[model samples]
Target: MNQLNVSEFIATSDFRRFHFLLLIIGFFCVIFDGYDTAVFGAILPSMMKEWHLTAVEAGALGSYSLFGMLFGAFTFGVLADRYGRKRMVAVTVILFSLFTALGGIAPGPKVFGFFRFMAGLGLGGILPNAIALLTDYSPKKTRTTITAIVFCGYCLGGMLSPFIGILAIGNYGWRIVLWVGALPLIFLPLAYRYMPESSFILLREGRREELLAVLARINPARKIDAEVRLYEEHDVSTRVPLAGLFGEGRALSTVMFTAAIFFHLILGYGLINWLPKLMLEAGFSMNSSLMFLIVLQCGAIVGTVVMGYAGDHYSLKRILVGMYLLGSVTMVLFALNRNATLAYVLIAVAGVPVVGAMNLVQVYISQFYPAFVRSTAMGFSSSVGRVGGMLGPLLAGWLVDMSFSIHSMFFAFAIPGVLSAISISAVQHRYSTDRSRKGQAEVGMRLAGEVEK
Candidate 1:
């Protein structure tokens, strides 16, 4: 049988209609993730007032969902590696949507926190798998771009949440605002019908016939058949996917990347959760605060696209490092600036790296590991970042509780951004050094072989 590496087949294939369809399905899933997560921020004022929650209590309430996300990202990631991406994707969507609708009925803080936690589990599961599936389908020439495009769904959903809040939360109530999160159910059937199983998983299972058929559909001209045996770049014999992440001279890089994610997320989720409230405290009206969120998301969309394009052409690590540094500067500026027009402009700049960098990390981690462990690595990195995600809101709220100056609160948050930049730069330097050494070894071997001949 002719050996056909499914990863190679996919990485070399031309972009097709099927590819577009895959992007759409993953896109919508990300949108729901964005909307569900951001809605909490949008309606926080209303929810806090109704429940009479202290700032610390409100921060704790937000952390409950982030905690859920931490568990969900890790759990579902491992499950996706074991069970298959399609099933986990479907399961997570249903799980989060169900819990989101249930959130509307929550009578008090504990119950509300419970429902948010449940929904957070689903939120945690969706992104990594979505990125993994999309990565498997995409060509290398444009993989980063496609991943960013799909992630833009998240930015769109986040951008829309405030508008929904303006229209629905103001008139109806915060409960009604959360009820809309259930709307993803309408798209669930479409996702199930259209989403394909990960081709790499099929290859690993030695499902030749199925793999061939999938390959053919991805590119009809390839004429894949029974004679073809699917191959993969990663050794399938590496039975433990999680161990593989820490093996292969990858331990240090993995730890550094995870640390980078942790710091960046603290900055990212902290801003996302509190930006509206921070603006309100800064003397902007409620409506203006929501508008600032919209602008931030809008900037996020542009930043995601810009960074994706840059990543494809330049050093991905350098791009991230620069973005993180810029993010730190922008956060400091965002807090100090009181002029409405200037603050909007500063927050928009902040959004480019603060929010957009998270999307970059998704694409970055996907490229870092092989298909066998892609989801696991993504899940682990994101789950680690969830530590920051969980702490970010709580820290911000605590500062508010303690009456820390707003500008200084942001200055403290900026420290993580600086640390994130340093962490990513270290990874980049290691990667570059390794590549150089490998290149030198290859040249040495080639020269010796020539002399021997």
Candidate 2:
């Protein structure tokens, strides 16, 4: 009687064509996610002028979508765990893509804000599912690296925002740029057709035929007897109640993780949402200000790659602690430097730590909790972190309305860096759900024996 444990098989699976395909799927999803988030920032200047909206009003509009995201994370993040990751991901992509297109054609600010809020729900839902999906299948040795590479597409999409704003708005106005949000609908069919459903969900439901199909695709060369049985190694811990997130010596780290994410996002959303407007106020042309966002995202791409590699090699916790502190310095320099040329360079440098911190932390959270609760953990943190995401823009608008100096604008941005550093510094690493290297190595060995039965 041949038997296979799904966890052991996935942990030991080689990185092959199948894994690379999955990487492409994850990368494209993140790119659209980035594009959707950065779109508001890119269009804000144009939208403000055309709509004659005040900074405070514009900021409130921005928070509407983030508010929807807060709920989406709380709702879909948990639903994915129950309904199926692929299905929930598909549903989210549709919700955001179709509604954002509606937002583009809206005649008034109120309607646009309404549509965007609807899109935000889908936008917010994608991350937990994407992170959960990638982590479930990626080789343990390369998991962090792979996740970083995929999520960096967020910055890649951000890099395109300014260029799209320049071209689309110049030709067809802001609505054209927004209309582009629906392009993901075209990408959906291909993904739905190729992407495999989560094995854990399948196993829990006892979907034998589907599991067999996925197992064959995951390891095409490995022989599987027609009657091979599938099972999970029973662990008392895996069966624990969801409350285990706060129990089992994990309560402190949970709070710290939520706090770190909150502070990081305050810096992240505040910067992305307001950078162009702040630059315009600082006396640059609209085009020049938009270009700064490109530099920032390019810097983010560089940061994402570097941090992912570094975190894989060093302690992710320690690296994050240092990165937040460095972000404070970069943000301050970027804010005070009036020279457009120098500002571009400084802002780009700022994106590395600020944007990179966002990607790496999501990767960390996906790893921090066990698979049973992984999606819920990510959802809860994001749902809470989104409060910062929601308030960052609103607060920035208030600062602008108060007529704070550009330097003060970023100085507000910087204080959170220290707070974030303090928060992440407190997380206890001994409780991380990630398996140790030696244990993972043993899982790899066990695969060979199990396949021969």
TM agreement with the true structure for every prediction: 0.93, 0.93
Q: Write the per-residue lDDT of candidate 2 for residues 261-281, one digit (tens) a residue.
A: 888888898889998899899
Worst 10 residues of 2 by lDDT: 444-453
**Model 1 lDDT tens row, 1-453:** 355556667888888988999999999999989988888889888888899989899999999889989989988998888778999999899878889889899999899899999999999999989999899889878899999998999998898788888888777887887888898899899779878888766655656566566777789986755554455655554366789678666777788888998998788777788878887888888888988888988988999999998888887888888989999999888667767789888888888888898899788878877677888989998898899998889988999889887788888878999999888877734433223344544565321100000
**In model 2, where do residues sit more than 4 Å from their true spots?**
225-227, 233-244, 436-453
Model 2: which residue pairs collide? none
Give RMSD to native, each candidate: 4.8, 3.4
Report how far off residue 186 is in candidate 2 (Å): 1.6
Cα lDDT for residue 407, model 2? Answer: 89
- The TM-score of predicted model 1 comes to 0.93
The TM-score measured for candidate 2 stands at 0.93
Report the Cα lDDT for residue 413, model 1.
77
